[model samples]
Target: MIAADSVTVYRGLEIGAAKPSAAERARVPHHLLDVADPAHAFTAGDFTRLARPLVEGLQAEGKVPILCGGSGFYLRALLRGMASGEENQVEAAAIKASLEARGAAEGFAGMYAELVRQDQGSVSTVHPNDHYRIVRALQAMALHGRPWSELNKEARATPPAFPGLRFFSLEVEKEELKEYSRWLSGDQVQLTIHLDKEAFISLSELRAIRSRTPGTKTFGGLIASLIELGMEEWSLSNRTATSLPKPQRDKNFSL
Candidate 1:
């Protein structure tokens, strides 16, 4: 199983991210889970770069690879390849990491100033506080080899990453999208928590949480992050009690 979900890629975002259980993984080998640092922005481009090899290698071995998750962006990018002349995701991510590191060391104000100096068009378009776009625009300048905003303006073709790639989507009646949205808006998801059956969070508390944590849009994103971070910390502190290794990054593991 190759997980395509964005949150599940993070090492410490297990419970909230709906990562497969140990028993489930033991039954069927999984790939791409916990292979990334949550601190970094793992783009669809990165997913394509990492997952392409896994899929191709599985085909070479005459085995079908199952990619399961709700990351529509990752799935699409992998099936339909990136546009021509795109930079490799690893290098792009590295460049982004360098830019972010310098932003910290050299002050983001100075970094932003440098960006505005180089590509005022890109820098001017985004809000002053839009840090993600600021770093991304800088990364694009680095990747494009210049601050030429006209470069990507030309039309380009996006082909499938490989010859045999296929895509399948499942849909529900009405997709239940309206109902689901309402539930996510603040209602319980037919799930209950308990401290001896009486220690449940109140509806008001849920409303407050929904209001304050407005970004809890995923079914399990928040829960997974909290549980996995706690587990990782506990394991690190009690190394003598259990033999849980910190999730490894860099290398892509396959069956």
Candidate 2:
């Protein structure tokens, strides 16, 4: 709602989406949330396309663009720049609108069926609620005899334009961050934990302190220990605390 230097995709989504509440909506203007019906799916690339301009325009006006969302991948793509080829606003809008109307009339399932028949590639991963995208897939199939998914895949395969961009993850500590599981959706928590150490924490503990305390580091000591040991066993102190904690303890020692 309040489009500034960066765009804030609304928070507090319900029904499996984190959307901003009504009170929250009045507090600030938001751009994307409940933009798609629950049945519809929105892709990172699509979001990147819509948000990039919002971000750039905000900067152009000397406003700071903030891309805020639970969808870290979406935020990353927008900031890093998703490859959408060159923008053809007229064509893009028309294409998007036409697809929405057509999908509405044809019914989402029918459209998805047609998409699968024509472009299995897109159907495999595209969600049903994502009517806009399903329609787009069908449109691409009619035009190119291939799924629009191919372009998306190609885009992902290509590296981000602004490779130098630094993505900072707000980290939380293990024992401290253990409370997030309750408030966070399973997928959100899973995403936060994936490839990170906190994933090992019991869901109950994670639920207890998630909001109160964040993990000290994104990952856990286990992987770090493995990395340091490098396939050779070392005199690991108190395996859990011995590896890294000992050094910190030593640093803190001395009268």
Candidate 3:
């Protein structure tokens, strides 16, 4: 599933961000996930530059591009538009190590205090445990003697470029959406399962439909749960995939 929609408009950040599990991805190919450290600012520009081509390429190959996440800005950037300013792809590991060293020498709390002193605005938005942001804020301060927070304020004001792209926003019914979210987070899916139209309809009515059919059963129960909640049509393709990895052929097509 394309995480574009899921990443666009969901609350409860962490679990929402972790919407697509490893097993789920093993079944169908996914473009981007966990690309950003939750503490870092993952801008729309980043998504446009990195993810847009993947989505388009998959489409060109006649494969299904399931955009399944809750980052609305990212989805908009890919389809409708993008926010301005290049993504600050800092060396998070290096920055964290530097901060850790600073904290060890002077004090971790003191280092954080220094970050606040340099840029209170960014600090307010960033989590305290995010050493990477703290270090980057400090670096930004050292570079210009002004806080990174102030820079972000200026950056956020700039508008993105993407007015012509089409947007088919999936509007999930409230109660159903809640149940679906729960089902997605749960480990109900134990085996990978791909289905045809006949199989899909039959499985929808029977929770243990796979008992009557032969397919990957890992996440069949989860799919059933999602169907019961009423699936929203964000992006589904009738295109038969021609260029996916060999292992993924069965997932994108009815074999």
Candidate 4:
């Protein structure tokens, strides 16, 4: 399993971040934990770059790699790859400084208005008070001659790193599940299961069953429940206790 978390990514933050205990780690091998120093800034891009290879390696070995954590942006970056451009850091910094100066002189409201003019779609995504992103978006528009939102849309159109991905969100409230469903609408997931609190299964038990079953098809009632929950593609099982077909090495697993 790989963690897509920011708080737990840093070293020496166990208690503060409420990381899994050592006993839990002993039960399942976890990756990307305690990888960065507290002083180092670990961005979503950095997490995606590091995790992609690890997930691929596990898949190559015919092992399912579960991704866990609460860092939505990092998870999105890992799943949908980032926009590619050769950044001119010096020019970007200059532009950022100029925008900051403009904000200081003309007021933040004016700078925000400029951002809205550049890409109205970004208004909902970015907080109105977020000066850093406001400057960065304007800088991107200045450098690329396109809005940051447009760049993001183009990046999302790129082929996904992992196809045939299934997402299972366990023990989520109905409201949160609805929100997650909306957020993941464009992901093209093969299946998305949202289990209620009553149906919650212990992670250790679930892992044990998966390890023992290998590719054993059909979780009888589980499949039924999924179907009832509006998954029409799932059909009744035909295969016996046989190994599941090994997924392509390039695919990723998430939970």
Per-structure clash totals for the candidates? 5, 35, 19, 1
On TM-score, who's better, 1 or 2? Answer: 1
* Superposed model 4: Cα runs more than 4 Å off: 84-111, 129-139, 171-255
CA lDDT of each candidate?
0.62, 0.50, 0.51, 0.66
Provide TM-scores for the models.
0.50, 0.41, 0.38, 0.55
List runs of model 1 lying over 4 Å from the truth.
Answer: 76-138, 145-156, 173-175, 187-255
Which rank order by lDDT, best down to worst? 4, 1, 3, 2
lDDT of 1: 0.62
lDDT of 2 by residue, 125-238 (tens): 578766545755665445544556776676677765543344445767875555665444345435543434333343333221121123312223333554568645444444
Total clashes in model 1, counting residue pairs 3 or more apart in sequence or in different chains: 5
Model 3 residue 88 CA deviation (Å) reads 9.5
Model 3 C-alpha lDDT versus the unseen true structure:
0.51
Top-scoring candidate (lDDT): 4
RMSD of 4: 23.3
Q: 193, model 4: CA deviation in Å?
A: 40
Instruction: List the candidate numbers ranked by TM-score, top first.
Output: 4, 1, 2, 3
Q: Report the lDDT tens digits of candidate 3 across residue range 1-255.
A: 555532322222223134555587699876655455332344455667777787777778987666665555466556544222333345533544466567557765677777776666766656666554455566555545556776656645555333233445577799997897676556434212323332343433332122212231334555666675553332232133444546645575673
C-alpha root-mean-square deviation, each candidate:
16.0, 19.3, 19.3, 23.3
What are the per-residue Cα lDDT tens digits for candidate 4 across 62-115? Answer: 999998987766777788865434467677667866886787688778888888
